[model samples]
Target: MRAGVTLRSYASRYWEIYNKISGDNERVVASTFRMGLPEDSELRESLTKKPSEGMWQLMGRIEEYKRLEDDRLQSKSKAPMMNRPRQTGFPFRPRGGLTIQKPTAQMGEVNVTFEEPVHRILDWIKHEPYFRWPNKMGGDPSRRNQNLYCIYHQDKGHTIEQCQVLKDHLGQLVKVGHLKDFVLDPGDRVVG
Candidate 1:
C-alpha cells in the first residue's frame, strides 16, 4: 500500500485550510489547490490566482474579494426582503385608538408655560417627527392605570399629558429654540 505525502497545508482568511499532497501519492497540488490547481472540478473552475501572478497582486485581489463578501453578508442581514411590508415609521399609534381622559394625579409639571396647550403642540410635533419616541415602561401591569393611554409610549399606563419624560423633552426643545413658538412668558401667565 502507498502512503500519502503532504507537501504543505495552505491556510488563509480567504478560504479553508487544504492539504497539498504530492503527485506521486494522489493529488498534484499547488498552494491554490481548491481555487483551481486540479482544473477538473466545476466548482473549482474559477482560477482566481495564476502561478505566474505577482504576490502583491494576489493579496490585493484577495482583499477585494473579502470586502465584497463582507458587504454581501451585511446587506443580506440588514435589508428587508421584498416580500415583507416596510416599517410604518416612528411614534407608533395604538391599534384600538386612545381614550382622552384627564389624569387623576398631576404629573409632567414643568416650570415653563407654553403659549398653546401642551397637547396641541405635542400633536403637531409628533406628526412632524421632531423628537425621538419614548420606550415602553417596565413595571407590574396590575399596578399601572389601564384606563389611561400615553401616545408618547404607544402603551396603556399613563396619559400623554401626564408623561414626565415627554414634558422634559419638550422643555429642552423650547430652550434650544426648536419650540420657541410654543413658549409663553412666565410673567404674562400663571401655570395652574
Candidate 2:
C-alpha cells in the first residue's frame, strides 16, 4: 500500500480511539493529522505554511512524519516521566489544590448550583491563559438572531447561560477542588 493510504488508515484508527469526527472532510482530517504530528517534526511547520492544501498534497509529507511520531510514541513508552524534557509554551500553572479525582463508574449527572452566576465566574477567569474559548459554532450568520452571545464560543447562536460546554468545564473544575467557593454545596466542601 502507498504511504498516503497507510497514513489515512493510521489517522482513522487514531480518531476512533481518541475522538469522534463529525465529518469525513479532508480539511478537518488534515487539521487533526497536523495536530497529532510529533512536536519536534518540521512537518508541522510545512503544514502550517500550506494549511489550505488538499489531502493529495498533504500525503507526500506524511510518511516521514508518521515514522517520527511512531518513534516518539515508542520512546515515550520506555522513558521515565521525570527524565523527559518539560514542554514549554503551554500556559498551564500547577495549582496547589486537590489532585485530580479518578473517574468513577457511579458518576451521575449533578445539577450544580453555583454561589454566583456563571457569567460572573467566567468573567473572573477570562484573562487566564489556561482558559480557552471554544471554536465558533457554525450557522448561517445572517439568519440567526444576534441577541444571545456565548462568551465561550464568542458567537451569537446562544447565551453564556445556555452554553453546556462552559458549564461542563466549570463542573470539572469544581469537582477537582479548584472552584469550591463557587459551588453551592449544602454540606462542607473543601477547596483544594
Candidate 3:
C-alpha cells in the first residue's frame, strides 16, 4: 500500500481509540471531517479505506506547551529580590584641620653697611622670593631686619650660605663664619 494510505489508516485507528477512551465527541467529529469522512459516513468503512496520523502528533504538541508553562513559572519563583536604596550624594566627607594664615607685617631694626645703599637693600628684601623655602625655616624677624637681610643678600649676590645669623635662626646655619672674623668697635651694633 502507499505510505500516505498506511499513515492515514494508522491515524484513523488511533483517533477512534482515543475518542472511545476520552469521550471527546467534538474531536471525533473534527477528525472525521479532516479525513474527508462525511458526518453520517460509516466509521468502519472510513477506517478500512483511509487513516490519519495527525491525532498522536497533536497530542505530543499539547504536552510540549504544558512543559514550557511549568518552566516559566519555576523561573519566576526562583528570582532574587530587589531591595537596595539609591545613593544621593558624595561617598566621603571633608577633612578638618588648621586653615592657612595670611602673611603679616612686623617691625624691627637692621644695620646696613655704609657702602650699601639702605634704600637698595630695603627694596631687595621687599621683593625677595620668600616662597623659595617653607615658612618654618626661620623664626619671625622684625619687619625691618627681614627687609634689610632680603635687600642685602640680593644686592651683594649673597645667599643663605653667606649669612650665618640668618642661617642659624633657620637651623640651616653652619660654623663657616665666626663673630671674631670681623672687627667690632664699642659703638657697633650687633643683632643676633
TM-score per candidate: 0.41, 0.38, 0.17
Question: What is the full ranking by TM-score, best candidate first?
Answer: 1, 2, 3
RMSD of candidate 1 to the true fold? 25.1
Model 2 TM-score, 2 decimals: 0.38
lDDT of each: 0.45, 0.52, 0.30
* Predicted structure 2: lDDT: 0.52
lDDT of 2 by residue, 106-143 (tens): 11466566776665676566434445555556768777
lDDT sort, best first: 2, 1, 3
Candidate 1 clash pair list: none
Best by lDDT: 2
User: What TM-score quantifies how close candidate 1 is to the native fold?
Assistant: 0.41
> Which digits, one per residue and each the tens of the lDDT, describe model 1 over residues 41-94?
322333333432443334344344434443554486684223222211122122
> 1-192, model 3: which lDDT tens digit per residue?
123332223333443233334343445643544455333434434443554345443434323432443355446666422321221111111121212111111112322222222222222232123312212224333432321112123222222324433433222111222222222232663445
As a whole number from 0 to 100, the lDDT of residue 117 in candidate 1 is: 47
Error of 3 at 94 (Å): 81
**Clash count in backbone of candidate 2:** 1
